[model samples]
Target: MASDPVTLNEFLTERLGAGGVVDDPNDLLRYITDWAGDHRGKPLLVARPRTTEEVAEIVAHCHCHGIPMVAQGGHTGLVGGAQPDAERPELVISLERLSRIREIDPLNFTISVDAGCVLQSVKDAAMEHDCDFPLSLGAQGSCQIGGNVSTNAGGLNVLRHGMMRQLVLGLEVVLPDGRVWNAMHALHKDNRGYDIKQLFIGAEGTLGIVTGAVLKLTPRAQATRTALVAVPDVAAALALYGQARRSCCDLLSAFELIPRACLELAFEAAPDLPDPFDTVYPVYVLLEVAASGSVDLDAMIEHLFEHGTTAGMVLDGVLAGSDAQAERLWQIRERMVEGQQLRGEHLRTDIALPISSLGDFFHTASRAMAARSPETMVIAYGHIGDGNLHFNLLPPADLDLAAKKTLLHDLEAALFSLVDDYHGSISAEHGIGRVKQTSFLNGLDATERELFEGIKALFDPDELMAAGRILPRTR
Candidate 1:
């Protein structure tokens, strides 16, 4: 397979005709810039396929032409994983048009959908059948299931429902050589051979393009109890989390840590959002418990608070009295992201540590950053239940954006080193996209790097399936 620009264009026009080709530079703009505006690139062409067959055809043509392929979903990825790198002139295969909900099995509690289907759409379809697809995320409204599966996305509900890997029963992927592997078995037990579908789960599209998926659904929760509690510090937050997990057991759906800074920013951005506490505490926990049937959730939460307060774990608390109050409380969490986005230059790190080490991680990270640069603000917050913290570092308001770049490398190093020390993952939910590839590779040993290279060669020998991703070049 070799690339000849003129020859390939002619072949594309003859094969795909006018159906799914987008070569216009202006039209290709959306595919170039990443969702976070951190990375930008120019994709030689944008392929918008309407079906699995069309996607296969595109991949086959790209394979034969030695034209590297980049699979893009809703382009809502925070990392630059969806966007092509500046080094390569790759073809962007957007799965937006391949969006089609194939089937919904209420009895089996499974839903089959095309990879291009919006995550929220799939969740809505599951709800239509009286089931729940619990992979909830900030970008669910636009991000595709294919992207979610590719990155093995871990959303806010990872504490309860787990990641995309748990929800996904099977996947339909097109290999680098353009062969479709339809492993769409919706059965509970199938140890027939190698669990090959997993190879593409978190490969970051380095292995192949996921075209379709059969996802397992859960029984819909009929009742929920939501509470916003204040903790004196991270240690108290962890104590509250332990109590909630023990009391609620499997019913514990979410336990989120919200720093005072995050809440302050939210209040500044959205004044309509009601403050849960009269006096802002240093730390806050957004906790929720859900069950499939009606139960006295209020009493359970109230009872927990009664004892928790006595133990000095809960400094202050506010239970959502009504549905409107519940939604308003959730709004505070949702607005956290918006507030960060609107604020000055910041670096958002998605790292997960051992649940017990979360407080230490935050304390150490804040101290390290402040020692290195006191003007830097560390707005630490995330799912304490799952130990995934979006430990965001905000630059001084007076610091120039360009000047902040010079300080990023050192700050990121200190933070990642701290994470590694805690036996935590540098990337908890967000996959290691191009932006993190160098650091990701540097963290691996020769043995691990060798295995990564071997697998990359096996699935993508030509180095054409999103090469230089996860594994850097010069391997």
Candidate 2:
């Protein structure tokens, strides 16, 4: 007299009609994993809800049945946040059907969109009204707005526009117990107690499912200037960054640092990408300035170049004369990730420290990594202006599979230890999804760890939403 497994197909078909549930193994296979291809989890059924009411019904049904559920958006998360554990019979609630731009309030400088709306679509919708959605990334075409909100994603424009948290004005979420909290409103200042929208922004869907959002918009940039400047060293890079900050002020949209090794890899990976400088420098910076009003951006860039040249802060520079040229310059910066991948197995670390401590952090981490594994290839680059660095360590070319794993483990431990020494974060833009769950526990102390658990409990008492993600299980 064993109980039968829940007939998820029948359940979904009955509740949402045959169109809502997809039981085909081929279709389900794609939703079972994440962008990183690290986690492979299967679900009893993949449920696609078209409306908020449908989502509410599905969540409520799963809650009543004590069935574990995972909410998935574009599945572009780097930390395996959207992956489900195949060992368990889980239900994947796909937001693909919920894709829609509900409203655009240009007067309020906000756009209301369903959680399933792709990031690029939102940006396009904003542009339709002559407004701009400041939050953007390389995955703009694939990643969804709900996923961005869930991770509080930061991108190239963070120096000017801030993170996803800043752009989100309000949210509509479905609680675990089946109640819908419709807080979707475009309000600049609301003294409402608690500001519940903040709870779900970076919560990674652990608390509740984000159904929709009211996002802030900005005026489209009328003028933009991009430059690829070569610095003498890390110190000079920091100096030039300070000068740019002072001169350009708020117009300074991006200031990214790229190591020579990263550029080499980019050139290797992308055969068409041209080198900006005539000579290969130790470090190169991709800087951009955007203004809403009429301004001589080229003159401002020329002034910065002249100053840098005089001070020896910059050895050489190139300014993009056209939009195509600007995109070409940006391609070198954006392809850093793809370029690093060509090197083979590597342990990537996205850690952030104070801007003042970046040089020391890099020196110490590089030394520590070299001492541990002299042959390891280190590819380091990132948003130097905001102090976030991507310190990626590649396995030695001569090492075997087993040896490489050991090296990777040691490298991660040493790098994370150095990050801790600087009182920096282990994961910066990427949320603490499954990939960093262990790191999260290891990084936090007793008090901080307890507080994290308390917050999770406060939001999701049943621990049903995206379980085994940000928090570690108590043994």
Candidate 3:
């Protein structure tokens, strides 16, 4: 049987030390919520473990007593994957204290770090050795490597470097039984049987607790080009992307789509942010290309501009002249989320579809939004190159909280129905934490659910890890 709150608290304090155990409501407040402020939980206690051995001990104790637990790092996840269950007496195992750079193999082009190491710190460490870790995100400064790996994060650089799954070569995870599995090998080729490490990469901490990782790195970009090109519509943007890929090839780092509405909100949110052009076009494509060695990136970007203009895909554009100028152009993309926040209650859906289906989806979704809520504004944008769209809805701002939520819920159903029609994922880069659990499961086939459940049973038979997270707790 699971121990009582008092027993669990004493045991945690004994194992993790009094300083490591946070039962005080004030401190627990920080661990209870997520970065998006969308989900909150009531964890019995937050346990801060300083080492892998300490994590194992805590897990073993939990396993023995049938106590549920959730592994956390930075708590910057959009989905409620890391937050403890409000109903369960779950322990929040925060890995922040395990922050460390175990090794950096410059020649091998890899960096192994503790799960608690912040994403920006890992990037900085790689840069110190003249290497680059390309998993770039808006929350990189606060998000941890473990959480990024767990969610299989795809950020601005995903078009160039791929997601966290591609960058992570190996991992060190603490299983539910409290046994440590050290597969943290920085190997480029491991043709051995089934890749065991792949299981935990995007598992959302449902299967086990990730403690360390060996991540792949690339050479720092030596030459770069950035431009914000105004396109007539999604088709024009698509043509521009194709031209960019053919012209710049592997150097194409980011290709983001920003609608005029999103930009307007961005302007409202950050007035100091300069406009890229005088004429406000219908849509904008923020294109960035980088190379490690000698290559005429300037000519490549110039050719893209020339071709886009000739093809009538480019309406108006601005090519960044300097690093500062490039950063300024990128700021428009970065401030988009803040713009959504400024707009009040909004439904954010991270869905991915085939590149060709984007235009159809856009038009169809617009019609759907109009039919459902005529006053609701659709402010959509995302990494167009990867077919991921952050389809968002800003309903009538004057509605009260309850009314707003009801409208959002209805709008979400309408949009997701479109997502279903287009045969796209409801959750792309972001894992289906607590937010999309119902829809995610409803969409899954019986066989798929069975397989998932069997796998969960194999790794976490007790279902004590991350209760009611990706899947509901059987108990």
Best by TM-score: 3
Candidates, ranked, lDDT: 3, 2, 1
Cα lDDT for residue 374, candidate 3:
93
Lowest lDDT sum, 10 consecutive residues, model 1, at 1-10
Give per-residue CA lDDT, model 3, range 397-448, as digits (tens): 7889899899999989888888988899898899888999988998899999
Lowest lDDT 10-residue stretch of candidate 3: 1-10
| TM-score for candidate 1 | 0.96
Q: How would you encode candidate 2's per-residue C-alpha lDDT over 128-160 as one tens digit per residue? A: 998899886888899999999999999888888
Error in Å for residue 189 of model 2: 1.2
- What lDDT would each prediction earn against the true structure? 0.86, 0.86, 0.90
For residues 26-134, could you state the per-residue lDDT of candidate 1 as single tens digits?
8778889887777888777777778888778878888887788899999988778888778777888889988899999899999999999999999899888878899
TM-score of 3: 0.98
Which segments of candidate 2 are over 4 A away from where they belong?
1-6
